[model samples]
Target chain A: MDLILTPNITDPDGFYARLIAAHDGLSDEESAALNARLILVLANQIGNAAVLEQALALAQVGK
Target chain B: MLNDRYSLAFKLYPYERSSDQDAAQPVRHPVVIVGGGPIGIATALDLGQQGIPVLVLDDHEGIGMGSRAICFAKRTLEIADRYGCGRPMVEKGVVWNLGKVFHEDRQIYDFNLLPEAGHKYPAFINLQQPYFERFMVERVRELQATGTPIEIRGKNRLDAIEVRDDHVVLDIMTPEGPYRIEADWLIGCDGASSPLRGMMGLDFEGRVFQDSFLIADIRMHNDDFPTERWFWFEPTHGAGASTLLHKQPDDVWRVDFQIGWNVDRKEEMKEENIRRRLDAFLGEGLGYDIVWSSIYTFQCRRMKRFRHGRVLFAGDSAHQVSPFGARGANSGMQDVDNLGWKLGLVLKEQAPESLMDSYDTERCFAADENILNSSRSTDFITPKSKISHTFRNAVLQLAEKHAFARPLVNSGRLSLPCVYDNGPLNGEDALPEAPARTRPGAPCPDAPLADGFVLDRLGGDFVLLTIDADAPEQLDVGGIALRRVKLSVNDDATGALAERYLGGATSAVLLIRPDQHVAARWAAFDESAVRRAVGHACGKE
Candidate 1:
């Protein structure tokens, strides 16, 4: 499943980068799974639409 | 009457004359601690607890004055518990749950340190340091009464120390006369202006911030302020800085003001000026009376090395940081915790003296990180220049309005404990792919056990926890003993912890040492593998 995740408002890339970095030694499937789990946790923490928009913008920039 | 009380209080005579010293000479203890402060008393307590004889020589007749180090972190409480002192400490201390930051009259940020679900103690407790020291001294006396023979030569001063290959000899000056003492190890726990550190010719290198702070213990009636830490940011007073208000025991409040460098030190500390600042921040016409006040300069400095041959340094003698996040004394007590068990092992012949090198390595790492964070906070509070001030204020402003910025700003970088990843005891597997855990190099996270006791309950010594539900494997390492306990994976709390820490995976076993560092861990419940990992870390074949 292709999943699109948004970041938190302050440093969306920072958390995403940390998640990716923690899983850097894992297999491609493992990294993707971990990233998906982190996205859910971050989404639960920053539940605001404005923050979600900024996070989405940050993710796009990283891409 | 006094002699009758003294005789009744003791099981045996304390001051027995040794044959080695007759009328010609007096008996000298093996180790003589120079200062009677918390650090000195703690060192003596640790050594005495291990059956080693020590005489603490203090210039004061009683425990030192002042309520210094009123804040104790969870990690420190773990250490105190190991020394059989944590119960009283917890009973007397005031645990804080929330902290608020205000700018002018508006609430800028409010953070809650919700007790971690599995941890026994809260994040921090505020207690008077003098009471804590007295408790330690009384514990020492109790040990002495039981023939443990921990001596404290009050009104005694250290004149000189000469280090030899075998022992460190101390020349002490007492009220009666001069004496000499020889010790296997000499520890300097004296404050930042440590004479021992200076005598050893070691350099304490770091930036000394020009800003000075005023700490006042006062009695005030503020019903609005809950039993939480309140920080007033950018006050109109001397250079837009911060003010701290912390609740103490017995209706007393400890307040700290970050007075800028512009104010003269002499004029800033005047009683009238201090009262004025207290009134301004606490609101007008609040019936408040000042108890005691003092001015101090904040400096972030650490010795180039913690150990120089036989002499070791702990507490403020080893490192100094600004009192922004209460890292200074907490980290020093942690230094004692790290060194105590290792020194005990060496003295007991369980481990070689070479193990002492890890104390320097581990504590230096902690000190370095503390200096970095405290320096950052110091810079944040007292910006060196206009550009720096503008930048800091801009970041804080951004943090105020943005949720993302809030966590980033309050990363609480100062409070985070740094593990020794590259220390002697930390092996090749120390560099784990997973995030941090309660491991050898890292401080143990507070975990709640099924019995209602927290993970910190197991911290006084080495603990072996089995996460596997079936057929828990048990194997012994060479010299390091392991106490095995079954962690029921079926419990709801265990399931949550497995999800949070192990990424929803199981079958891992963890071994933690008394200092709350993860000594070893096995991905799968393999007895032989766990034994080998423990053996390697403990320097046993």
Candidate 2:
């Protein structure tokens, strides 16, 4: 399956606000955990281990 | 020992005032509810309020003995609000949304469930289940007083169920003797360890939790602890296991201690052992009096199917989850919310019987979601495997220093409403660029309407939310109620409704089902479009 590479999110600001809202009032460590859980949730939705590995590699390249 | 709440033996009042079962006269009704708990009575109230005749059978007489299942979520309160039984619960219940999580006596993080509120109800109410059940029971009684044709037959235990082609025959054991009654539809709200489930030869299958926990509600006159949920993982006081504390109404504080699995269950429940443990766990001297105490083992299990020919199951009979997330009774209430209206419409011949299939499909999906979250929470708290324990500890360690790791620390992901995405009952999403929230197959997000909340406008009918446009004068609902209201830009003072539902569309029409789930949306109204959407929502298409 191909990855979603296009700019798909219509309202980026709104989406970001919701993402921040989900982690609002959480401490920095808690925020990190929330991000980890979010990544895990997305990875599970992705389901393909190869795609997950490739995505992890891509995410690591920028960092 | 029975707690103070159950010591008086609540007046049962002989609900079945008269019975023809001993005479072997099989009385028929539209619906037969087989449990008298909160879930059962809530379903009966919802159905009875809609003019659907129902007969409820319960083995016990009055409210449950102890304060079990105290936390009621906002979505459940909304469902109860629809039936006029939720207000008293909210008034008397302790409302709280902030939850504080700690790791070994160090404060880690806190969460606000509802950051901003445009909705009618708060995020949750820490009310005892018996009080909520009593409210629903009184609502049913009020409906009965109004001649809505409902029978609450206490002590009429369901001994046997004979599921025929189109109806159900129930053998109920009454105070005098054995008798039978037939019903067009049978609902088993009979809780976990449901006799009805066993009678039907069905199995509750899933992971069996090994660890045991002691839950106690104690009455103390301390005002130091605020109204919030406090959770500790491996506290010095708790001796390595997790603990949860909450302040309930009537100066009662609910405390949970994760005692190990190998301990003697009965001996652990003894007052002496309980007092000894509480002294160690709470750190407060012997001032507080224990109001109720019970031991429980967690399990994340559910029935394979919610519907069986003419017999159906709701609440614990259909699904059972650990008590961490407050999902048990809340999900049970949502079960009735999904089934009640469809059953009412089907009985009235307004909607096809096939609509009930959507209940099975959507609710089973929700049950799976609840099971998954609950299972994950139990694993995080207990961590059976070595690697799992290492990962959990690392997350907790990292959570103290970084914000991202904080979300990984799950004390118990408090209950949230399920969004039924892409279900069979959802009408087509014909309008492109529509908002994500009010998309087809999702519960309509609560918004501020004039003088009330959005859910306050929805119930007992298909509501068409027309924005900046006049409601169509002519549309057929096929004997089912259809409500059409026009909300102008001025009507939504806060603009939360417009931002969620109408994203720059001058005139958008949304078709919502009776359960307040979005069935379809169109940029413009068309008679045939509405007819088709209604057909699909009613499961006729």
Candidate 3:
């Protein structure tokens, strides 16, 4: 499986706005649940679990 | 002030005898609902709304007394709303979508449930079971005032049921004595310790957790806590395991503290023990009064089949899951949603009796899904093996620092509506590129419409929803007598409906069943295709 490392944002501001809009009126617990679901859906679309693990490891660097 | 004439602020309803046992003849009814809990009453009200006469039998007269089953999911509220009791719960219940996970006071991750919008109800609400039951009773009484009265015979315990080939004969023990009643169909919503199931020798099979948790409902003058569900794993307060905080209506805050299985039940439930635990959960020196506290052990078990000849089971009688995910009442409501319309149609001879089997195949599948999730949560929370505990601790530690590990930490999976993808009732869709979210088997996703949401237009009958096209004048939908609803969609008025239902296509028609599950779909309007799908859905094929 190949990971898409290209610059993917068409409208960064719009994407940022949509991301913020998703969190609107949601509490901390609900936000956590939403994040979990997001990770899962994105993982399924990504298809390859090995690539997902690598991407997750990369994203978690220096956190 | 405590005189007999004085009006009490609230009182437990006195059980009244609805049947005179001395009467010579046996009373006959179309439907007999055992146990008048939320599930039974909801089913009764739903059936009654469709002009079906139902008799509800229960040992208790009033609503449940605790702040039990606190988290009502969006799907449940939607079903309640459709059945005439949803808005009140949303109005009064604490509607929240955020949650914070703390592994020993360190914040891990947060989530938003309904991120992409278009739903009328929130993702979840913290409404107690009592309020839900009261709201259902109110709806039943309100319907009764308008002449469609569902007879609820309180204090009438179903002593024994003699199952017949055609119908069921129930020997009910009332406060006045015993009486025999006959029913064309008997629905057991009698809950976890269902005597009806016991009488029929049906056994519930699944996992039972070895841990018992103490739920304390506390009332205080001033207690400030966040509305979101706050879950703690090995926190500074309380003894190990997991703890949860949820605020119900009124000044009551429900705190669940996991107590190990070996402890004495009575000793643990003592006021001093409860107070000590509360001190650990909330800080010491807090001014609060204990409203109610109960110790309960959760088990995820279910019957092999919900349907038995002329007798059907709904709610806890059919399936029970650990209370962590709020799956019990929510799933029961889904059972009501899945079964009510089919049962009503079958009683009316609109659909074949075999249509009822779909209820078993569909809901039992849902029950298994719920049980599996709840069991996983239980194992995570109270790890049995040494390696399991180490792994849980490691996950908790890593979750605080990483985004990926955050999803692995299971406080509770939380209840979501089940998608019946592989059920026998669904038809094969021809269009592969169509939106799978609203596919043939999936529960119809709530899309924004001009008048109301898409699901609001469904529920009562077989609806043919056409997007960016026109439905034919009429469909000769075979021998089945289902009321066909034609919803003509104009995309210029509503933006999301076309994108959500039709995908990129210009036109499509979806055959939505009475329970709001999509039975079939078509790229274009064809009468023969629609009729075949409808026939298949109603078990007429």
Candidate 4:
């Protein structure tokens, strides 16, 4: 797979809450570390290098 | 009822009494079309020019007033050209190829739809829907003068239809009274609110957007705006959430404002309210007359099947999409283009009735594609959720300086011809290295030939086109003659023909259909393979 940018989430609000709760009691440095680790895990799960590169490029667009 | 703005411009088809009214029994015709709109008239022109007698019944005496569906794509013009009426449309239209997108009054990026061209028509033209219909009706009248056997009865409305296995019985309501008529086949182009579809008890299902847009066409003598499509998202003028501006002919401009979902439609369409919005967007004291205004809400929906027994549906009666990409009328013309020849063949006994099934399969596929695209554009333009809105704004802001994010900023994808990727009528595709744009199940792209254009000669019949490839001058398979058109890449002044038709292959042979879609293509011509592909295209295999 390719990067699917459409609205594919089944429960967006619930996922958002869960994501926010993950950083609950962590320092700023810990929260940044957690975000880094999360990105790596998802990228590894995707597996395809081209798709990972596309996601990387898209994430860096506004920067 | 047509508004008093502009209805008496041309009474193209006046209500005239026909001898069929006084007939002892119901008169049986080969084909009867309901709706004198562009699609119905184009279908009539297609069938009548092929010597098929057609009768068109319309509720109105002439075209209704409105500049609805202004952007006609290139493929639509090409199809109209084959119907002998593309000249006036292209001539009278205000052609536009450039589009600019702005985010909150800051110009982000711009695009040119036709950067390189060796084609006959532009990427798109902005023409009012009424003029488009009037030109086609004029073509019908011209063909009638030469006795082509196409009759359009004004003020004739289809009250009900009885679909039979072999024919359809129609009850038409005229001003004088109602009359009964029998048709071998009935075509419904009666538009989105199709009475024929309603009477048949069909399901038209899809997504309805929770948004509304107000269209105000104004007339003023000024050169303030260029002939380009300009779109803005959350304008600084606070006109609306989003807005679009386009220039049409005769000093008229089409302005569309995305008025939010929960508003009084009547209050929004008031003259003073419209003027307020226009004044904010265009600046005060512009001094323009409101030619016409309407508030519209769109849905991305379509029927389950375009064909049901003897009655078939073309145009908006069968499908609909948000007017974002201008896919409504353009796709409808393509439906007529695809169905016209297949229906013609079935009527002539040259092809089996099963051929009509391909029309349903292919046009439905096209409708789904159109719906998916327009829906995506709508979601981008009008974000439903907060997170989605943030993403949209971020994409737009990044698009100003970042090339990578430019394609992500979706104002509207714009209308393009749909390719039947997995259509049932498609045959073998042996030219693996050939350009995918000219491969099987794709509409043939036009190229400038020595005489004129490639599309000018390919449509209206089966063409066996050979480029640096050897094939018979003519091939007759299953009573269908495939005329050979031999041409070389040297015939073109530019090398666009070779680039579009042949990628790396030295020679190519393409079997083109009557609608100018590539049925099959091969590196070399094999008589048996050609015959089988021809048979397959005719629904004989």
The best candidate by TM-score is 4
DockQ of 1: 0.05
Q: On TM-score, who's better, 1 or 3?
A: 3
Output the lDDT of residue B16, model 4.
88
Q: What CA RMSD would you report for each candidate?
A: 9.2, 7.6, 8.6, 5.6
> Could you give candidate 4's per-residue lDDT for residues B1-541 as a string of tens digits?
3222236446778888888889999999999999888999999999999999999998878888889999899999999999899999999999887889998878788877764588998877899999999999999989999999899998888888888899999988877888899999999999999989999999999999999999999997566777788999989989889999999999899999999999899899899999999999999878899999999999999999999988899999999999988999999999999999999999999999989999999999999999977877887799866545666787787668666556666677778899999889999999999999998999999999988989987869999999999999998887898999898899897989999999899999999999999999998999998999988998885
Candidate 4 regions with alpha-carbon error over 4 angstroms: A1-63, B1-9
lDDT of 3 by residue, B192-242 (tens): 989899999998988878888999999876767666778899887754467
True contacts kept of 1: 0.04
- Which interface RMSD values do the candidates have, in the order shown? 11.1, 13.4, 13.6, 8.9
Candidate 2: interface RMSD equals 13.4
lDDT of 1 by residue, B114-148 (tens): 76665566667888787777777777878788877
Highest lDDT among the candidates is held by which one?
4
TM-scores for the candidates: 0.81, 0.87, 0.86, 0.91
Cα-based lDDT at residue B30, candidate 1: 53
lDDT of 2 by residue, B240-297 (tens): 3988888787878888989878878888888888887778766756478889999888
What is the Cα-based lDDT of residue B464 in candidate 1?
A: 68
User: Stretches of candidate 2 above 4 Å error?
Assistant: A1-63, B1-9, B13-17, B22-24, B284-286
Error of 4 at B68 (Å): 0.5
Predictions ranked by lDDT, top down? 4, 2, 3, 1
